[model samples]
Target chain A: MAINKNSNGYIIIYTVVMVVIVGALLAFLATSLKGKQDANVLNEQKVSIMKAFGEADANFDGVVTMGRINGGEFTVVEKADQQAVFELLGNRKALGEATDNLPIFQMEKDGVVKYVLPIVGKGLWGDIWGYVSLQQTEDNIIITGIVMDHAGETPGLGAEIATAKVQDMFAGKALYDATGAFAVRMQKGGAKNEHQVDAITGGTKTCDGVNAMLETSIGKYESFLRGAEAEVEADTAAAEECTCGECCEEEIVEPINEEE
Target chain B: MKLSKNFTNPLAANNPVIVQILGICSALAVTVKLEPALVMGLSVTFVTAFSNLVMSLLRNGLPSRIRIIVQLVVIATLVIVVDQFLRAYMYDVSKQLSVYVGLIITNCIVMGRVEAFALGNKPWDSFVDGVANGLGYAFILVLVAFFREFFGSGSLLGFKILGDWYTPNALMLFPPMALIIIGCIIWVHRSINKDLQEK
Candidate 1:
């Protein structure tokens, strides 16, 4: 073959050889970094979970001590006899049927279990998600921490939802009442009580979305909380029987003749 | 060797985007913000200059049957190196650039130079040719980006250049503005350089 700068065959052979070399190099580099990349992703998830719990100051490397709600453990529970799946928004049967799944993390301390579950909802510009922890007693949920990010929202306005002050509002907020009615709401002007979370004035839509997300996400755990409460009552009853305390002794005395 | 007007001409007279109407795709896509445009300009410059140099050097020994393939191979190789370096160091910028950096392998500017000048010239002359042409491309891109970033975001290099009161024009962030800006540049360039006007 005549060698020429303009020849097509020369270019073909050169291209093939160059491509082979470059491809091999890229493959080697990718493989070498694969492990580190995977580890980074796992670390990020752990950090997100920790930050959600307001435990950002806790040492993440060492063994995490579980609190009353197992800070490290979470679970997914479905409401019994309810077709509506607990979701980030108010229960929508269609949306529930689509995902039909939830996550709950349990933090265990001295054999007691506390669970942190995640909440997801839509923000003004994009989707928002957060985590909330509940006590085994089913009395209320402590807003441990939250994380919010957006796709294309304005930087200073809607984006402020991710700020610390905004996320802090969720701490120690209750998800339900004695009647099992979900009362979580984002007040427009300001929160009325410690239990009510104040909405982001600039981010009204996002606040509404978050309010909806919490009701739906927490509502799904209704059945799980009921079961947990029942189990606790049974355990407490059994423990009381074993102890020869004043109450137990009185019960054993065959209810000293009511007339006397 | 006498410096043919062809060697220095494109830097201004036949500028790629502003004059020749080539490479406008990147000019619009990356110009939405300043930093990405700057990085994209430099990346293209590096690829163009080196690819031209390499192609000219091998022009003599290349087989007549496959010279174009060899040109593409050289351009593609240089592009990969640039892409890797960006990924290693400027990871955030690289992420923003995403697949656009890799798409440089197919940029018409690099291929056009190799075909037009590298095949006909000596390596040193070809290197200069590459630099001149690449600069011409960069000049247009920077001008477009300056306008886009300034009006669109009220900032430069992510710093707020416009005062607190200045509201950004959202339309500038989209790709359509790039085309309009490029058209304006061409109009101005042609108006000033009467010889460049279409007959």
Candidate 2:
């Protein structure tokens, strides 16, 4: 007796066989490639963050925790990225709210400690995020650089925000103005000052997204920034104040010869 | 020579994309870059050939009521496997192709061949037809991508073909431009095939 190919039983059996085969194939392939894919993703994150910080080749010593801007300012919840590091970027879930623990990337260059924070926000289509490094010298703190990327944005339009030229606009821009407000803005038409960067011309929604993302995400770390600045200032002042009366005597040693 | 028409007809006169105008969505999407277009073309060609083969083999057993469902399942599985393979091996190209690779399951070329030629034909004949249709689609996809990437991006694949003085046309990069380019190809094809013209 020949099997009936068009019977309901045959079709049902065929469907089950096909689904199981495809599912098994997909699962096996995905599982096998998961390690490589995760490595690729992790490498990409490192490259992008480093590029954003204007130091693509800078050796990432390791992840470091920045003391809260005011030692209890906002909580930066760890475990954000399944890694025990400072990827302190706020998303839709943590927006306008304090994070449990904000992760700051610390890099020591030329005796100065540079702090890089994570940025995460919503774009027109999907998630937009990047790393922004803050450089503090003897006096003030400024954005050393920023690098942003998006999961999905219109190519050549909204996606232009991820280009080197766009990210370069954030370098050396002050994190806050005289009023101590996080003042970085993606100004449409043209940006007039250091705190502003021109928005992508036909990519208004994405630019608006970057603007709000930076504003609020950076705003969430406001106290931390202020606290870091004050700490630096106090450090500089304390070293220069010379307030001890007991050891006021100065030693008059001969100046060392130069170029010996 | 007599058997060649099955493999050659779709290249021009019986083309799946231009003459029949069936699978235009994927054509518009993956044709923006030459590399992706090539990848997509290969992907389509592979899926069409394999799906056609599988459909022909199962055509006798398939219930008439659920033939379309069977065809879809075959095409979808083939496309997903291809997508996964691409992600694993061609990671960069996979990233660029993104959703368009998954969208291949919707490309009418695969299903169109199964419905038109595969069901009643021998596996070998159906495979030939599938390859021909796949080539036909690839032909149009490459042509569209050639013009789109060259004019729109001033480059082919990743190499710069045009001088810096040549400013790329932003419009050509748009999805509508793919349609326009396809329209132009159709116009040219029709001009050569006067029989295709309407009275």
Mind giving the per-residue lDDT tens digits that candidate 1 earns over B32-71? 7678778988899888889989889877776656667777
In model 1, the runs with Cα more than 4 Å from the true position are A1-260, B1-8
Q: CAPRI verdict on model 2?
A: acceptable
What overall lDDT goes with each candidate model? 0.67, 0.76
Off by over 4 Å in 2: A58-98, A137-140, A239-260, B1-3, B161-164
Put down candidate 2 lDDT per residue, B1-199, tens digits, no spaces. 3459889899899899999998999887777779988998999999999999999998777778788987988898889888877877787778777788888888888888999889999898899888889989998999999998899878898688999899988788788989998999999999999999999
Give the true-structure RMSD of model 2: 7.1
Worst 10 residues of 1 chain A by lDDT: A81-90
- Candidate 2 at residue B78, lDDT? 87
Give the TM-score of each candidate: 0.59, 0.83
Model 1's TM-score against the true structure: 0.59
lDDT (Cα, tens digit) per residue for candidate 2, span A1-260: 99887688987897898779878877887899877776666666667667756678864435433333334354433444435443223243452355646555556666767777777777888877777888865445688888887766766567677777688888888766655556788888898877888887768899988888787777666666666566556554556764663322221121111112
CAPRI level of candidate 1: incorrect
